[model samples]
Target: MLSYALLVHAAPYSEQGALSALRFAQAAVAQGHRVSSVFFYRDGVHNASTLMAPPQDEVHLAEGWRALAQEHGTELLVCIAASLRRGLMNAEEGVRHGREAHNLEPPFVLTGLGQLVDAMQANDRVITFAP
Candidate 1:
């Protein structure tokens, strides 16, 4: 079984790239392949926002990704620089910026590009989903 790493660079609502990546990851796992990690970069950092509240009838993209991570033990990583630029912060960042709340929490970690490089080096295959 091949180990896969996914890189998503699109926002959930803005495009289908993230959704497609999720499906591919699920299918890969079901087929007995291992998914090492999912790296969210660029606008894709929006997927890690805890403030996302979609209509009940619509699918919650963030929740979907979170569930996948929970069930499959897949690492969910959002680019720190990209997330900061988009105002998506963890508790530490919120405290540093004098904010009362943070949008990124557990199951989604903020990391550097070095993590992406590491994923590429560790996984057997790296698939990128872009908008």
Candidate 2:
């Protein structure tokens, strides 16, 4: 099976980049390919925000991402620096920063760009979704 690594560089609701990446990943898995990892960078780190609450009429893009990650065993990695700048922090990070809340939770892990490089090295293909 072919292996893929995706880089998402747009906000979930601001553009279709994140959504497109999800669809691509779903299609890849449906076609028997493997999605090794999804690295959220720049504004794309907004996808990891836990405070997002879309209206019932609109699709919850984050749920779709979580579903894809769970069903496909794909890793969801967000850039630590980007996430922090965007206020998406895990528990440890929140405490370290003396923040009252942490928005990023399970299924999403904070990581460095080195993980992106690792993904590039490990996967057969790397796709970047830009705004």
Candidate 3:
């Protein structure tokens, strides 16, 4: 089976990048290809924010990505720098920055660019979905 690394680099609702990456990941799993990891960078870290509550009619892109990660046991990594810059911090980060609590949820880990480079090195394909 082919292994893939899905790199998402856009905000959740602004454009189709996040949604497109999710759809592509689902299709890849359906077809039996392994999605080794999903790396959220730049504005893509917004997908892991637990505070997002889109309107009823609009699709909840963040929830969808979270669900996919849980369902497939996929490694979902949010770049620490990108995440913090955008106010998407995990428990440790939130504490360090003096925030009351963290909003980033499980299955979404805070990591560095090294993970991205490693994923690209190991995967059969490194697919990027940008703004």
- Best-fitting candidate, scored by lDDT: 1
Evaluated against the true structure, the overall lDDT of model 2 is 0.91
Q: Which structure is stronger by TM-score: 2 or 3?
A: 2
- Candidate 3, residues 1-131, lDDT tens digits: the string is 89999999988989898989999999999999989899999999999989889999988987888777888878999999999888899898888999998989788999999999999999999999999
Candidate 3 residue pairs in clash (backbone atoms < 3 Å): none
Q: Where is model 1 more than 4 Å wrong at Cα?
A: none
How does model 1 fare in lDDT?
0.93
For residue 72, give model 3's deviation from the true position in Å.
Answer: 0.9
- Provide TM-scores for the models: 0.96, 0.96, 0.95
**How far off is residue 13 in model 3, in Å?**
0.6
Put down candidate 1 lDDT per residue, 1-131, tens digits, no spaces.
Answer: 99999999989888989889988988999999988899999999999999999899978889988988899889999999999999999999999999999999989999999999999999999999998
Better of 1 and 3 by lDDT: 1
Error in Å for residue 34 of model 2: 0.6
Candidate 3: worst-modelled 10 consecutive residues by lDDT: 62-71
lDDT (CA) per prediction: 0.93, 0.91, 0.91
lDDT of 1 at 43: 97
